[model samples]
Target: MPAPKNPLLPAVRWALAVLAGAVMVLSFAPFGWFPAALASVTAFYLLLPRGRRGGFATGWFYGLGLLGFGVFWIRISLNEFGNMPAVAANALMLLLVAALALFYALAGWLVTRLRPGEDAPRWWVGPLLVLPGVWVLLEWVRSWLFTGFPWLFAGNGQINPLPLLGAPLAGWAPVVGVHGLSLAVALSAGLVVVALRRGGGARPAALAGLLAIWLVGALLARVEWTRPADGPLSAAVLQGNVEQSLKWAPDGVLPTLEIYLDLTREVLADSDVIVWPETAIPSFLHEVEAGLLPPLTADAVAAGAEIVIGVPIMEMAERYFNGLISVGSAADRYYKRHLVPFGEFLPFDRQLRPLIDWFDVPMSSFSRGEAERPLLQVGPYRVGVSICYEDVFPEEVRQALPEAAYLINVSNDAWFGDSLAPHQHLEFARLRALENGRPLVRATNTGISAIIDHRGRVTASLPLFERGVLTGTIQPRTGRTPFAAVGSLPALLLAAAMLVAALLLGRSRNTAA
Candidate 1:
């Protein structure tokens, strides 16, 4: 890399960085332009600034492009459902976006800060090794920090990338998890960068490296990490298509209950297990316990069906939880361990609440459930459970695995309105299914209720904002994938090793220089 002679080059690079970030999001969700991710990463490497401050500024702009375009739905939730003023909602969205963009700033700053001066391209260490390491590590950090917003991860783009490409990137998921796959994508992009920058056989070597990754992924896709356990169990996922605006209204409560019950009655006869969306009742469990719970239990027993319904649970005087209870062959309750920040419960309430009156979203004050709540048991096998945002955290989804015959995620995505959020959420569920080698039954309030097999394929699904039941036979799996057994530790270790190796090379270069 050489110093630019053109004064305008800096501004041009910054603009392109922003453009790169904006389009990077296109690789995710409804777009599914996985190749766009490669393009974005290559652009990022080419445009990355040399100075620490410049790198930070460039990364912030890039992040502004990515998250600003990616998570605009947050404003919809705040404005439409939270009753936040449009100006305030936009301001809050920008605030959240800017805060998250700082992580990108850190990643960008690190590139320049940790570089080996002129020798950065020596082992192709700067791009191929360092960039991927830092990128995935930072992404892993974002997944857990501030109770984490692991949405729009780099790996999210690679999962089931175009059918024409034939599962080239997704196969690495079960072996290394989402973070590891993210590293692979980043590494691939870095290889492209290195190929373009160097000559005299370098391009062919990089091309070879790229081909090896793709070929290995394609091969892994053919391997079934887990086997089927028992005959397929019929599962019915209910999507009530409830409107977010009317969900918690005092009068809307009865209507909401009826909608779910009506849907349940329609499918109860054929389903081995009936699953409901989050807070399907729109009321606390105790409120409905007397009139609904026991009767529903009896109805399920009579119909020879098991019911897993999501509702709010109130404990003692103050604690309330977003939860699910089973009414069937065996009864069990699973409270949502991971609560959605601000939506489920506000952080720094004393400071923010007084400053902003609109912080009072309905049911935004629920308490976090115990860490080790029981998995819902239906018939002979245990089902791993996640409520709403919990499924986005891979480790949280991995908790019941190796024992949990299948995975169940109950969510109310109505908060995001009619947007890519639900579809993107379905993508995340697919990743979990593929990662743990378990069939996932995803039930949601607005739409995209789906039955995803262990292979991460959508076997059956309902459309968004539609009232319907998705019934499918999910084969229970009794084994764990490498990911399920070790979680993301291996992925983290690999990323760490890349960073360490890059640092050692950089140090040696500096010492020799």
Candidate 2:
């Protein structure tokens, strides 16, 4: 019945899968070789075996390679900042990586299990249709499942300038969002694989289709999705460059506040809007309102500017929120809705308290803000605000569009240290700017503070671990892109439809045989 399995074949496939996964990391920030993303996915697809178990094994190894190397910086936060033992932190990181790899293993298993019999007419169906759909669907699930770790996505790599190719396809972001671009990349990779296997007959069509997809993307990139609604305003983003080790220390509090306040004063004369990084104040708003607010508000009013700064807010007994407040303007307050698990607040606190206490993380008990909160009004413009990691979720950014003229995201990335995390985080922010057809101003505590235009291009930025102010003019856009209008619904629906079509096609072929 079954042919004898070759012992070396399994070893070769596993090795290829590992290599594919490791190489995929190069496609991300600090080393942005985007073409590698396609190649890595292609290599992984080629190694996947027909059997479901073998497919699972290959996928697991591949994911191990990708996330293991991609997110290695997590250890820095856990060991250096969380005060976890080096050995324990390394082990914990490994455990988390292995668990995340399960999602990829499931995707691989589904691809192999859903394939039609060998005699099926459409040999290209599995790679072209099913695999890409399964891959993107799982990525979407990974974004919100168990609080989500949406990092190092396929589309994030494309945010870097690609000469002709990047500038053109950049328009595709607003139509389908990052998940849709990932699907297109997978489809292109599939076409390349199919062309190699099926010989001359499929090669020309495959090549032509691949070129056409990119060409269309390039043409679409030329289209202006949104327009400026008002005159450009001078905005300044302040990077405090606070050290994570001393940030919450009793003696370090006032100095940290002074660092941001000094930087704000430097730019206030010319800036219409000034922004400070997350938790720049290092104290509750009420505690500082009497002393800090009066002077800051007076300065802003005298300078004829609006100031937005991040500070913690206490609402009820022991219930606090990570929030942003506007001064010398409409006095709007926006609280962060999405909270980071373990980092911002521990889930299942009673059960997990012991483990969390051992790690020694600071401010690990923030309550989430309401999702339907109003936008922050800065001077004449209505701004959408995302705190720290919230910009990574496309849906969160989309929720602020059409009404909010621009966006401001504040983060304290000092926790990540000297790693690729900051670069990757900036890339994610750029995509959000592209997706919503709105300008984005990102302020961080210790690096990658940037001014991104409506097209997702970084116009200016400050170096990492630098105490400085980035001043630039940002145009306020009024219209919404397709993504801002409909959100991820269209992309998710298309992925579902593709998977269903593949299943129906496979069943029909099996019945015929």
Candidate 3:
């Protein structure tokens, strides 16, 4: 591997790193340029310095570019909805982006520290095995650490159902989940960087290895892990398009209830089950039980349909939860287990309360539900329910599988407005469906409400910010995919093994030298 004749200056390299990170956003929703993820990561890999400090700096800049642009919607939620002042919100957004960028910096430092030197015989091992493993392991750590921000994974770009020249890339989802795909993407990028630098026999090997990974992924996409357990169930997903400003207002409560009730009544006759978005009701379940439940339950029973509605629930006055309840035929409830940090429950509230009181986020304080709660039964089928961002966690979704006939995710994406968050969220839902090999019925407020089949294909959908109902049929699947059966253990094990192999190979080469 020869050094460049005219190496880029430090300033130019940093700029390129930032540019590479920003370009990664195109690989996700709204743009859907899937190949850009590989290209962007490749650029980042090529920009990484041989020295540890320089590598960290390069990665930090890349992360700033990636997260700063990708999740800019956080500013929307803070400023527009949370009513945070522009300066404060922007500062907070920058702080969060910088905090998240540390993971990328750590990944870069780890790769540089562990990788073989430029002249080592096993230099190929670093890019092909070590870098991808370190990258994904750090990504996994970031997902759960501090109530993870698990967005913008490299595999997320492949969630689109569209195949590449007749090859379905999303097929790998059922076998390895998103982390494996992220690993593959990182490996490809690293290999590209290696091939570019080492123009020898290593070049062809790296290229061939890259092609093999994609080809295998395409072939894996065709494997069906779960099969239909029952006939398709007609479902009606209501999109009330409720405005965030008016949602909790004193006068708007009744109208909001009326909108959902009317939509349910309209679709009750034709649909087997009707799903409402997250927090569809503005008030507590007990408060509305006397006034709302009787009529709604009666109406559902009369139509021979089940109704699932989202509402806040008060448990013994002091404890409250953001909950979903199924009325009519099936009587069950699920409280959200994974609460969003700051958005749902503020962390370190005692310390931050003075500052936090400035933002006017409603129902921001809620208790997490018990993790071992039973699945909700709707008629003969057992339904796995995820509220809002819970769908993004593959392991969280897997807990209900094997027993769950299908999955239902209820969300209020109106918080994101017309940003890429909703579209990216929908993509997450599709990946969950593919991973679990279960059909997913998603009901969202203000857009991208959809019914996705086990294959991760959107069968039907409702447009964003529209007040309407989407009627679609979903086949209940009973079997589990390899992903569902083993969860992320296999992927984690593979990553660990690769890192071990890289370390051993690097050590052996150093000992010989």
Give TM per candidate.
0.97, 0.96, 0.97
Scored by CA lDDT, what does every candidate get? 0.85, 0.85, 0.85
Model 1: lDDT to the true structure: 0.85
Query: lDDT per residue, candidate 2, 1-513, as tens digits?
Result: 222333448778888787898888898888877788888888877778755558888889889989999998888889998889999889999999999988888878888887653335776787788878888899999999998888877767866765544644455788889988888777777887776656656788888878887787777788788998877989999998888888889888789888988998898899999999999888888877888988989999999999999999998878999999999856889888999887888889999887667877888789999969437888878898999989999888888888899999999988889898999999899999999999999999998999999999899999899889999999999988988899888878888888999988877877887
* Model 1 CA deviation exceeding 4 Å by range: 1-8, 51-53, 117-123
What does candidate 1's lDDT look like per residue over 1-513, in tens digits? 442422437688778888999888888878888878888877776677655548888888888889988998899989988888899999999999999999888888887677555334474888877888889999999999878989888888787557668668888889889998888888999899778877778789999999998889888888899999986888999999988888888999889889888999999989898999898988888887899987888889999898998999998787898888888778878888888888988789777887777565899989988857337787667889998888889988988988899999999888998888888898899999999999999999988899999988899999888998889999999888999889889889988999999889878877887
lDDT score, candidate 1, position 79? 91
Backbone clash total, candidate 1: 0
Cα error of candidate 1 at position 103, Å: 0.9
lDDT of 3 by residue, 1-513 (tens): 554643778788889988999998998877877888889988877787765558888889989999998998888889888999999989999999999988888877788788876666676777878888898898899889998878998888876543435424566789989998788888888888778888868789888988888888888877778887877799999999999888988787789999998898788899988999999999988877998888888888889899988899999766899888998876888999999988889899889999668877988989989959336777667888899989999889989988999999999888878898999999899889989999899998788899999888899999888899999998888888999989888887888899999989877777887
Candidate 1 clashes between residue pairs 3 or more apart in a chain or in different chains: none
Q: What is the Cα-based TM-score of model 2? A: 0.96
Deviating ranges (above 4 Å) for candidate 2: 1-8, 117-119, 163-168
lDDT of 2 at 6: 30
